[model samples]
Target: MALHPTLQAVTERIVARSQPSRAAYLAHLDAARVQGVQRTALSCTNLAHGFAAFPANDKLKLREQKKPSIAIISSYNDMLSAHQPFERFPQIIKDAVRQVDAVAQFAGGVPAMCDGVT
Candidate 1:
């Protein structure tokens, strides 16, 4: 079997359009990679400051990096219907991650704007 002509053309166009961005993103990731555990690269004081707000159990889980930690960054705001559903996502994510023996924190929220309303 083969892809339809229209589908193949659309796929080619998307690949061409994304090529530059994909290359730049790969380069950025390579630049960010470094030897050893990335989190341990931070100074103890800095690491403590980062972990200060976490609960005791989470602090212990994170200290040894025994369990994977997930940061749930969201763009949730009640003002936008699209963003509103994200409000419940963190707890849902946390519960799911916990079941997998991983930890998830609602790290932070970013500003969300609905251009149509704005």
Candidate 2:
């Protein structure tokens, strides 16, 4: 089925805008892909540096690469009504992860854009 004209135009525009970065990102992922345990590819010192700031117990768990590691990323801008609710999600998610014996870290925030707000 054909897309509506407006939808097709918007999709084309978005694809064009994202092409370069998306291609590069895909290439990077292809280059980084490996078999078996990925984290073990890092040197001991490098791995230590990655988890140095973690709590002592977490540090040990991460070093063993046994328990799952979770990165809790959110787009939680307080100014955006749609995103404001996400501010509380990291803690909630971490709490849930802990119940499953996984490690969750608030990795970072990304931009939350609302066209209506803009």
Candidate 3:
């Protein structure tokens, strides 16, 4: 499993931005690695679920892999999928951003939306 250059840049960008405390990042990463699975892992109900990615070592390798199939970043920050395959990539990244928004609300990082899903 060799890493591609594009993926390497992505991994680096995540690290640079998230700037997690080493221990917390490791813990969260472990949790995500154990709890997380591949993006294409299909289940009937999973299509509606939001993904949580924690920056840890095991997952980090996959995050660095060539062609980079999935995203591995802090669960709280919104992911960028501004321009992608007009189909699934947009949805997947939007889902991740929504998940972060939901969690950030509970943590009081951002104000809760009374109107919802703006």
Candidate 4:
């Protein structure tokens, strides 16, 4: 994804502050990816009901879906969330986990296992 001009400028400034070493810059980018996981998980909750009435064929179709990019991006998101880092509380993680789990179960998919792009 192309960074917005403002975000790009901000990233440049932050990276410049931690100068010479690129670790800070990479960390910043990874942090953004983690946030994307949380955001997608939340947004996906809204799409959960769509699966409630899925037939067996629909379940098969869902099973064929590739793993969601967010799963990888957020692989650590859940851990971080559990620790309440990045301002995410445990309850937030709990709720998100439950919602995600329900959606997963409904689709006959394993929690955080499917790529979600059928």
Candidate 5:
């Protein structure tokens, strides 16, 4: 199917506006890949701080860099029925990641307020 002209125009405009920043981001990733850099390269203090709350086994895996760690920032609140279902998302994501030998952490929660209440 052909894209609507309005949608295509908007997409082209967005792409033109983002060209510089996108190119810079790609360049940075290329440089990091060429350097063979990984999060394991962080200083001991920084790494320890990053994994301070992780379980011992997960911490060890992080140090070994054998698996990538994914951070899930949830914005779930029981008071809001719409958002309540998301409370279990972190564990679900963690289980899925574990199946692939990767690790998932509930990094933290973002503050959420109901617009109706405010």
Candidate 6:
């Protein structure tokens, strides 16, 4: 089915507006690919800090740059019951990644505030 004329016009305008930024992003991606993965380019101290909390096996693989690692950043804190369920998400994500032969780490968390409490 054809897109509605109004929708098509809007889409074209968005695409035109985004061209420069899209090209720049693609260029950056190509440059990074040529330079190889980010972790492999890290200095020794930086790499250590990045993998400081990884399990021994994962740390070894990451050090060798032989496997991919996923970082899970969450805004979960005990202060909000809504976010409490996220407490177990890191482990769940780690196990799922392990099944696919990748490593996962709970990179960090941000404090979550409840409007009702404050």
Best by TM-score: 6
User: How are the candidates ranked when ordered by TM-score, highest leading?
Assistant: 6, 1, 5, 2, 3, 4
User: Quick one: best lDDT, which candidate?
Assistant: 6
lDDT accuracy of residue 46 in candidate 1: 86
Query: Candidate 2 residues 1-118, lDDT tens each?
Result: 9999999999999999999999999988677553323678789888777787677877777877777678888767777676667678888997898788767788787664562433
- TM-score list, all predictions: 0.61, 0.56, 0.20, 0.19, 0.60, 0.63
> What local lDDT does model 3 show for residue 53?
43
Ranking by lDDT: 6, 5, 1, 2, 4, 3
Candidate 4 residue 80 Cα shift, in angstroms, is 12
**lDDT measured at residue 48 in model 4 versus the true structure, 0 to 100:** 58
lDDT of each: 0.79, 0.77, 0.44, 0.46, 0.81, 0.82
What TM-score does structure 1 among the candidates reach? 0.61
Give lDDT tens digits, candidate 1, residues 10-100: 9999999999999999987677553323668789998898778777877887887667778899777777776666678888998999889
Which tens-of-lDDT digit does each residue in 1-118 have in candidate 6? 9999999999999999999999999999789667755685678898888889888988887877767788899887776778777789899999999898889988887554553433
User: lDDT value for candidate 1?
Assistant: 0.79
The sequence of per-residue lDDT tens digits that candidate 4 reaches over residues 12-112 is 99978878567877888889766543323434555455444545554444444432222112322333335346334433543464455322231222234
> How many Å off is the CA of 97 in candidate 6?
0.8
Q: How many clashing residue pairs are found in candidate 6?
A: 0
List ranges where model 6 is wrong by over 4 Å: 1-36, 111-118
How well does candidate 5 score on lDDT at residue 98?
Answer: 80
